[model samples]
Target: MEESSALPRISAVDLFCGAGGLTHGLVRSGITVRAGIDVDPACRYPYEANNSAEFIEKDVNELSAADLRPHFPDGDISLLAGCAPCQPFSTYSRAGRSKKRGLDWQLVNSFGGLIRDLQPTLVTMENVPQLADHPVFQEFLSTLAGYAVTWSIVECSKLGIPQTRRRLVLLASKLGHEGLAMPEALGSRRTVRQTIAKLPPLEAGQQYAADPLHIASSLSETNLRRIRASKPGGTWRDWDPELLAECHRKATGTTYPSVYGRMEWDAPAPTMTTQCFGYGNGRFGHPEQDRAISLREAAMIQTFPRRYKFVKNGDPVRFNTLGRLIGNAVPVRLGEVIGKTLIAHVSASRGATGAGSGNAQNTLF
Candidate 1:
């Protein structure tokens, strides 16, 4: 029976599963990701192709526990993972606003309600660090008081991801006084040069012939000249007087000097946003190339595997659509850490139960 019986596993569903970044990482750590739910139809190809999970192209607000139950298996620990769109909570988006709330905000509430209804054995969520400040977040925390909740703010670069992003990672379990711990960091920081140095070089607006996605966005003649003058780790202040944008002369624009800057080769990249493919957005210019980083390069910085196909063959690689997908994704390496942490918790719980029963051999990790 030991040979024939299935090993205990945690079955998971990824909510708002953009391009399956988190799902891919968790799957790598031995979790059975049963399905991914998102309203974006564009995510279907990558999410389904990269993992053995069904893709549900529907609004999360319309889903219920009954609808989700069929996706998981009959006998196993049930888990739910979600990272709702974090735009409203982002510092960049809320720069001048007094208040912000929208449909995406409601999605967070819906996620909490689903958890309350399903009462899964484990739950995990990742989002912008700013999320913890909002009233909605406080409401969400109230829902978790019944469970053992552990959350922390982490820098992605410390976790072996090349981009410099700060995020909130939360893990909750109903299995008695569990705490989520930060995964051990790489002894040294993972730098941009260490991540994307060896790929064949390409000019602005050029694509690698072997890979359709390894293409950079086109730069205008004026911006092209401007990029040439910009030094790595330098801002618009490095530019010639003639190449400066009109706003840069103003005090308000001086506050946003990181714009039109190049990334430092020896350091982790600035946080990639939806416009990471554009030269004027943030500090997205390539360290040496006179162009913004390519779509493939951005995904790699997000710690996705090199050959993780995002689109089908013969499809045109559209920049805007893909930029949204890659920028909003959780780093795959972080997801793998969460999976391993949860797995260890399950093992520890089983070991404690076995000790109580005086059957030391009953636990298996």
Candidate 2:
């Protein structure tokens, strides 16, 4: 192989780069992200607008090593981040396994195939913790035969993301140094108040004029009443018996207490889901507001900047689309932590200095 002629710097390609969350964090942490590839065209605008990286709309399964080589340039240290969509392996996915699950599981193999073919200097992957137990994960691991690998189930709250999400994080190095370790957890957990309290509040179904994404969904009369009765961090059990949904009154429904709940201002939020804007979805209702959290608030909990653009100037803000883009994104803070870990490992291996301070600050909207 010919030696790269460019100056030494970490350059990365993000797979499944929903709205550029991982790319933004990598850029923030001093890594040069060359491109973000995802099948969703909805991601292109935000991915390019926010990170200043090329957005390639292509399915990962259809991409070849040659298709990616042009993006890495000649001499930059190449890093590949493959954060496949995790819904197939997520606990939130349908209870029983099916052909659809089998199909999505192959995405992990496609990611592994890219690593095998490209053999980049560094590799990282993030997914739901449940994936670690699946055979697909073991098959993916087999692809890193020559690299030193380390993986752990990381708590997002410990990493300063104000959500109670746990994920599997893996780092692999082919540079003959120790595999990169996960960053140390922060001194304290961030809370809902700390992350989104300063934003302008909105009533149910109201939109903030200055920022379109700050709008909350309209609630039905019953849900409006349900949210009114909810206490911060409390479940449907706190609701007046008359206001209870039939499901909530049933034995099986009791298993789903977190639904129709309000997030506690003093605590981190529950995981944001694709349906997070709906008042009845998970514990997404605002602490004091009698409605589900706004799109902007949900993005902030996922660690996206308050002003992070989702919809374009004239486009409509479809709740389902925006919610999936934000909720499914790897938290920006978690991505930064992963980027810093890779930078440290590369710096150690090459006996060279790492880029920037790695203490990435949030950009204003």
The candidate that achieves the highest TM-score relative to the unseen native structure: 2
lDDT of 1 by residue, 88-147 (tens): 665444211112334657878888888888888889999889888888788787777678
- Score every model by TM-score: 0.90, 0.92
Over 4 Å off, model 1: 1-7, 91-102, 352-365
Superposition error at 267 for model 1 (Å): 0.7
In TM-score terms, candidate 2 sits at 0.92
CA lDDT of each candidate?
0.80, 0.83
Cα error, residue 71 of model 2, in Å, equals 1.0
Q: Residue-wise lDDT of candidate 2 within 1-365, one digit each (tens)?
A: 96533237778899988898888888887788889988877888888878878999887888898888888877778889968775565544421212233468767899999999998988999998988988999999999999989999999999899999898999998886553789658658999999989988789999999999999999999999999999998898987799998887788997898998999999999998778888787999999988899999999999988778888897898988888788788999888888877876776776665353344454211
